[model samples]
Target chain A: MDPTEREVACFEAGIKFGTLYHQFAGTPVSPESAASLERAMEAAVENQPHCTAVDVAILVDELDTTHDYTELTGRYMEVHMRIDYGETVVRTEMRMEDGYPMMRVVDVHEE
Target chain B: MDPTEREVACFEAGIKFGTLYHQFAGTPVSPESAASLERAMEAAVENQPHCTAVDVAILVDELDTTHDYTELTGRYMEVHMRIDYGETVVRTEMRMEDGYPMMRVVDVHEE
Candidate 1:
């Protein structure tokens, strides 16, 4: 079955964020693109009106690989991403090196 | 005093990582840019010969703001980044919405 509208909206928001983030990393973008990005972001927030209540985090290791490039050699980060959720917060981290994603419940009192 | 070469290297690596990360995030780049990014990655690894020994994680909430763009409105994530360290792992999370970054030692003994 297809994803629900809200689910699709959330996924789109993530993609839009990722797109704009990279697009504007060290350069300027056209005002038109910026506007589109802004609209997407707003839609995302609206889709997750209660995102403030979820909290999450993820960690991973031994997930990157080092390859030798004939002209240029280096390691590519293949980290993992994690998420933590709770009564009033939502946290998400992606560890690209590892292939799996994790979700957890947070304990705020200990800290 | 100015940052040491090694420290500078670390900072540069972070920057380069961010740069390449955003640059090649969704779109492909020229072979030249790709090669340069690869070289920088290798240099970063050489600089962090012992990153495998550190562990860290960061969590934050109450970040992001919505602004009116006239033409389009959306929220921007101004999160904080937290780092967790340990004997064999290093975990870092950027909470863009929050203003502060955090660091902690992992308690792997728990599930």
Candidate 2:
């Protein structure tokens, strides 16, 4: 699909990067788009000079039968962003952990 | 893609029904599979008699450039299940609010 359609899919899928933990419950992404996602991650790193060497992993798990709920799942992304506050050239790794649905900013700390 | 390919895609995407939020960041899902997902939701409901009408909405949002992170995104799925503890017929709507890459169960309770 084209970018516009893809955007619509995203919109329909209701995936907001900020609130991704609440979206997709559990299912694998298609290959066609997966390639673009990897590229997007790379771009996310390249675009942000303050951020560098970002690593990400998507995780999914099945829910126990006891809860009558579908499988429980989420995603995880880690990044190394450069922090420069005017004069401070601080290099730190920012990890976007425990993402749900697509991805989310779980915790950002110096690593 | 066939079921196997689709499953593989999900696997590569690292999507587990238990933890889907950490995978996809900000981008729409392709259409071919979206239909299957909707079907899956329905099946999830049919399979679980304890669960009734499972209303789900996929939400994706763009993140501001304050921290230089990608757009904020996620998905949301709501479900209503019947509670029959041998005799108790409880009808409740379980909102699987905010699905991420594909989907993830964030919160479940009286809703």
Query: Using TM-score as the measure, which candidate wins?
Result: 2
lDDT of 2 by residue, A19-76 (tens): 2222332333443334444455545544543333344343212223332333223333
**CAPRI band of model 1?**
incorrect
Native A-B contacts reproduced, model 2: 0.00
State the TM-score of the second chain for every model.
0.25, 0.32
| Candidate 1 lDDT over residue span B40-75, tens digit each | 434443343233221111111221113211110011
Point to the candidate with the largest lDDT: 2
Among all candidates shown, the one with the greatest DockQ: 2
**Model 2 C-alpha lDDT per residue in residues B1-111, reported as the tens digit of each score:** 455533333332222232223333233344333445545555654454333334434322322333333332343333333333232333433333333233333323333
> Candidate 1 residues A4-30, lDDT tens each?
232222222232223223334332223
lDDT of 1: 0.26
Q: Which regions in candidate 1 have their CA more than 4 angstroms from the true location?
A: A1-20, A26-34, A41-84, A88-111, B1-20, B26-36, B41-89, B92-111
TM-score to true structure, per model: 0.24, 0.26
Candidate 2 backbone overlaps, count:
82
